[model samples]
Target: MADIEVTSTCEEGYTVESVINGEWELVVDALSNDGPSANEVLAADYASCYIPAFRVAADKHGYDDVGNIEVDVEADLDEDDDLVSIAFDMSVEEDLGDDEQDIVELGEDICHVHSALREELHADIAIESGV
Candidate 1:
């Protein structure tokens, strides 16, 4: 078993900063038109996670050196500006292209981020208020 954690702070409106391993990793300003929104983070993370998983799946299928596979992840939001759906698209390098569907399935099965997404988003709320 392995453990991972990231700290997110939203001290300024919709802007959030994520820190990992005591280093500032990502800064997202949801209120800014040019910055990445929360959903964008999800999409990017999905693709980032899947890319490695894809490599693993390909290796498992006896494919060596899958080359550089391009991936695009998109998030669709409703009129309320809430994340409603996520879509993943990728172009596998010809050198390792085989059973794409199986690769996707295996990738999702192995990717930790994919696993977290597959599981329901449940949080055990903890509150600390000082007034």
Candidate 2:
């Protein structure tokens, strides 16, 4: 398992932190008193998984110029219960010739993170779109 450690500091009215061994930098609001909750962690995991999957899918379908891809993941938590549901959505800009379906299919097939999460945590996932 991969391990990460974060050290946060209050700077400019925000909690700025650097995640050790992580590629992206994160900044949180200090005044909100809400940071890096369980749902946020889940969403970050899902989003991180999607980046490589999307890149591989685009390359396999001959989309050599797959631009930046953005993924949005949401986890719904029950207020009075312990059930959690996750939803994933993504937007990718690529230059492919009549192979959009193939790219999308590849992405769906390689999204192993969601499958692993479902098995480990018995969570429900709602996939709005593959691409």
Candidate 3:
């Protein structure tokens, strides 16, 4: 497996700048200026990753041109203030047969991000901060 690394920098405030492969930069900030909050970022990332999975699933079922699939992901914090659960509603611009909806749902399992979150896969989390 290839090792991928991204770097992020932030000041005391909410804005964060992330560099991907030392090439691309994305600025994620609090929603004050209509920027993306951390919660919003997670929702967007999951949805973005799911779209390709949906497309691939549609193709596998011998149906192309499913059109752009729109995924809406909503997440909420649990009692302990941890982001724990996500609910999604999707819409495919084109019409699929009655049974084809199941195929689309099956494709959702293909997204690694979605799968990891859904299954609550363990992660080695490390934090370094001055107290």
Best by TM-score: 1
Clashing pairs in 3: none
Candidate order by TM-score, highest to lowest? 1, 3, 2
TM-score of decoy 2? 0.56
- lDDT at residue 15 of model 2 (Cα atoms): 48
Per-model CA lDDT versus the true structure: 0.66, 0.59, 0.65
Residue-by-residue lDDT tens digits, candidate 1, 23-66:
65888887656468777777788778777987898778777666
TM-score of 1: 0.76
lDDT winner among the candidates?
1
lDDT of 3: 0.65
Displacement of residue 28 (Cα, Å) in model 2 is 12
Please report the TM-score between candidate 3 and the true structure.
0.74
Candidate 1 stretches with Cα past 4 Å from truth are: 95-98, 118-131
lDDT of 3 by residue, 73-105 (tens): 667767764677666666776666664556656
Worst 10 residues of 2 by lDDT: 121-130
